[model samples]
Target: MLLPQPRESIQDNQKGKVFFVALFTVCFFIMHYGIFVFVQTSMFFAVSSIYRGDLFNLSIPALK
Candidate 1:
């Protein structure tokens, strides 16, 4: 059976590490931006809904 050389194994390990690091970095940014946008949109919708409700209440006259 053929055996792996020490230098070649080291190089392979380095390549694997680099690939994983790059992948992690990309996924981290994507998740971060996704969460940020989701939160922003949710807040905007919540605020707008509350504002609309207040406007509706204000426009309606109170019954004596």
Candidate 2:
């Protein structure tokens, strides 16, 4: 037979589980946001670089 757990202990256990789940969810969102920002900035930089390259080629006809 299983031993009976105290009500207070069971409540505390449930609270801890909830806290852990909340912490995990917050961390996951933060990590996801960071990755999204990184991708956006990287893409912006890539596009800007390509644009600059085109401008540079256009400005100096001797380079062509």
Candidate 2's residue-wise lDDT over 1-64, tens digit each?
Answer: 5786566667755878867988999999999999999888767856765333443353433444
* Model 1 C-alpha lDDT per residue in residues 1-64, reported as the tens digit of each score: 5674465556765888867988999999999999999888767856665343443353323432
Could you tell me every candidate's TM-score relative to the true structure? Answer: 0.56, 0.59
Q: TM-score of predicted model 2? A: 0.59
Whole-model lDDT values for every prediction: 0.68, 0.70
Over 4 Å off, model 1 = 1-10, 50-64
Clashing pairs in 1: none
- Compute the lDDT for candidate 2: 0.70
RMSD of every candidate to native, in Å, equals 10.7, 10.2
